[model samples]
Target chain A: MEEREISKAVIKRLPRYYRYLGELMENGVERISSGELSSRMSVTASQIRQDLNNFGGFGQQGYGYNVKYLYEEIGKILGLDKKHNMIIIGGGNLGQALANYVDFEKRGFYIKGIFDVNPVLKGLSVRGIPIHMLDDLESFIRDEQIQIAALTLPKSKAEEMTALLVKYGIKAIWNFAHIDLDVPSDVLVENVHLSESLMQLSYNITRYEKEHPRS
Target chain B: MEEREISKAVIKRLPRYYRYLGELMENGVERISSGELSSRMSVTASQIRQDLNNFGGFGQQGYGYNVKYLYEEIGKILGLDKKHNMIIIGGGNLGQALANYVDFEKRGFYIKGIFDVNPVLKGLSVRGIPIHMLDDLESFIRDEQIQIAALTLPKSKAEEMTALLVKYGIKAIWNFAHIDLDVPSDVLVENVHLSESLMQLSYNITRYEKEHPRS
Candidate 1:
């Protein structure tokens, strides 16, 4: 499919489809109809069919979809079938948490190293990925052919580190920094703003209170 | 405005607007036209006007918006102006990371306690918030009037813990567990699927490669 044909909404929902199908596969479900999958996913059957059709329909009209087959196909489309080397650029609490995250490898992201300027964290390791000095980041990225850099740095350091990573030829960034980074249009960034999400929860709670006032 | 009137899409974007306006305020940007704000935000001026209009338009005909006033208005709409006491359940890596996170307090969610099933983790303190035994979760929530529960537990524990939290009167859950929680309609949950996002970055990288092939 051409890039223009695929909408941002569709691309965003691709991961949700990938996740739900993964669960079904793990549960040993062999097949599922669009309607059944839709019920499980909280999306409409037609919408589900439409999304899958964008990448060539994996579902059969009568036989439904082979769960494993569909999962693999979606995984392939998501580039999850091959390993992508990654590095965490900060060794702070959040960065250390991510370094210890076990699911990234299972989803085909191999964290090659963790980097920090702090002297105390230099020799430490989390889940076998040793913390390397920030000085080595450029050489490491080039040497390992690292494709993604996970920035867990402070807001003050985010822009500089992002530019450094882009300069060293990293193509994508999973940013956990509080601030946004300005990058060329070619570089992909997925900003995970924890505060924004917490605020959403705050809004929901407030809305609920206003709707269902205490009697 | 009534709960029925506002769309979820608008609710989701409130934090983004809040964040952007905040940056402008910090930079000493006193006032901004929708067109200028739109340029900085990468959103159209009409869309910005529409979003702000939901809560009664804050901008004037020619003067545009006062950055501080707009920021404060958005904060009020998002319920970020009031303090919401919270607890972090499951004192694991992710939970600990969040417990140490300073931004939540700055944003109005004050984490009062951390709970864990592990005996070793119990009685430990992170950022001065003690990790209490999981058994005390019920009483702690009641005593603290905790409005939010940040769940960073393993998937196996999510459902049971969610039920417990709801029973103890948790209004919202910020779930980091890989699995979806079964909650009542009134109980709000915002699932943060880390791997799904990583997959998105992977897909983007692949798309970039397809678009700009190495010669």
Candidate 2:
């Protein structure tokens, strides 16, 4: 299928499908019907079928989908089949927490190093990855062939650091910074605004309470 | 406006509008036309107008929108106007990281305490909020009136802890437990699948590299 034919909304949902399938695979499930999968996911069965059909129909009419095969297929589609060298650009709480997260490595994102401007964090290591000075970022990325840089820096420093990462040939950014970055068209950015999600929770709580007021 | 008239898609976009308007207000911009705001955000002007119209039509024919007023209005709509006491149910790396995060407080979700089954973390504090044993969770929630619970626990423990939180009367759950939760209709669960976002980044990078092959 042509890339242009796929909608951005569909692209966003691909990861979710991949995750649910992964869970099923881990549970030793062999196959799943669209209806069953839809029951587990927030999406509808027809929508699930439509989404899977877009990339060439993986589901058989009656046989459903082979869990392992479908999981592998989605992983390949998401480029999780190959290991990508990544670095955290901040050695603060979020950065440190992400470095210690074992799931990233399990999903083929290898953290080569972490970089921070603070001299106090220079020698610290999280999960065996040393925290290096920001001054060493360029040389480190070059030497390590780092493909992704996770920006957990402050909003004040986000844009400047993003420019530096782009300049140093980083291909993508997983930005946790509170500011929107201005990257070149070629660079891939996935901004993870924590507060936005919290706000969504806030909205949900308010709506739920209003609808189901205590008797 | 009736609550039923507001779609979930519109509810989700409120935070982005709030964030953008907050930025504009910070820049001392008093007002903005939909066209200008649309350029800054990626949304279309018509869609932005429609979304705002869903919530009592904040825009005017010639005046566009008042930036500060719009920001505050969106904030109130998302229930960010009132402070909500919250607790982190795990004192692991992620929980510690979130506890240290100051942005939650700025958004009016106060981290009242952090709880963990591990005794080693019992007395530790992140950003002045002390970590307590899991045994203290019930009493802590009762004493503090924690409206939201952030679950940063492992997938193996998520369901058990979720049941406990529900039993303890948690109104909302900001879940990072890497598992789908089973909550009653009255409870709000916002699942933050970190790996899914990472996979999206991986896919975007792969797609970009494939399309823009190096010369």
Candidate 3:
């Protein structure tokens, strides 16, 4: 498949589409129209068509889209068809949670190792993945060919850890740390700022309260 | 201050702005120009100016923006100045991690209680907050006047729990379940799909590998 530069907006929504389609497939739905899929997704029908068109629209004019085919295709587009070896940088609560998140394994992301600074947690394991100390990180990344590293470390340690990860030739980082990382342009970062999300929710709640003042 | 409808795009950037301003304040930066802030944030100067402009443009023509003032204003806009009481609907690893995350309390969203279906987990405390059984959920929510609920339950229980939460008057939901919840229009839901994030990472890795295929 010829890959053109898809907009970040479209790329962001692909995962949701992939998920909705998977749900449809699980419910035994064979095919669905753009209108139907859009309603299920709460996205506009035209927007769905346009977004799908970016990756060569797989819809038949009269028949709509094949649910199974669309699901598989979108999976391939999201690069979930291949296995990815990843490691968590801090084996704290968040790191352990990510390591134990069964969905990652289901989607082809294998937790090869977990690294933490704490010596007490060094020998511990989460979901059969051993937690290794920061000292062993360099050789482990090289030997295991770790493709991604999740930073669940403190903000103070984030930069140093990022530098170490980048030095060890890590490709992508799923950072949960409070600070924004300074990495090479080649390294992709997807930050999961829980506080930021909480702030957004707070904003929404405030808006709702103001708009619907109690009697 | 009068409130007007702010664009979702601009609202989305507010958190980043808030964080950057916070970092600046911590670094003893009392003021910053749009260009300076833009360089720090990686957002365009014009874009930063425009986004802040939505909240009365807390900037001077040449003197630049008062970082402390802007930070406080953005914090107020995000409703971070107010306290919010919340509960976790599932006491799994993800739920425990969220409970252990101290940043939420600093942001004024307090985790008052954690509810779980598992008898083994019930009565266990995470960071001093006790994990209660599903039976105590209703009374706890009502008694505490809980404003937010974080759903960390499995997909099978997500819908049912959402129904219960809606019935008991949960204002907002931070859903970590794989399912897209069906809640009332008044109830807000922010989904954190771990698999979707991994998929995005996978897509980026694929793009990077394609763009810079190792020799």
| Candidate 3 lDDT by residue in tens digits, B181-200 | 88889999887887877788
iRMSD, model 3, in Å: 1.1
Could you give candidate 2's per-residue lDDT for residues B149-202 as a string of tens digits? 999988899999999999998979999978789988878899888888899999
Q: Compared with the true structure, what per-residue lDDT tens digits does model 3 show for residues A1-215?
A: 77688998999999999988888988999999999988888899999999999999999999999999999999988888988899999887788889888878878899999998788997889989999998899999999989999988889899988999999999899998988889999999988888888888899988888899999
Q: Which ten residues in a row have the lowest lDDT in candidate 3 chain A?
A: A99-108
Quote the lDDT for A112 in model 2: 94
* Top TM-score hit: 3
Residues A1-215 of candidate 1 have per-residue lDDT tens digits of 43456877888898888888888988999999999999988899999999999988888889999999989988888899888999999888788888878888988999999999999998889989999998898899999999899998888899999999999998899999987789999889998989988988888778788889999
Model 3 global lDDT (CA atoms, 0 to 1): 0.90
DockQ values of all predictions: 0.78, 0.79, 0.78
CAPRI band of model 3? medium
Q: iRMS of every model, one decimal?
A: 1.1, 1.2, 1.1
TM-score of chain A of each: 0.94, 0.94, 0.96
Each candidate structure's TM-score, on Cα atoms with residue i matched to residue i, is 0.96, 0.95, 0.97
After superposition, the stretches of candidate 2 with alpha carbons farther than 4 Å from their true spots are: A1-4, B2-4
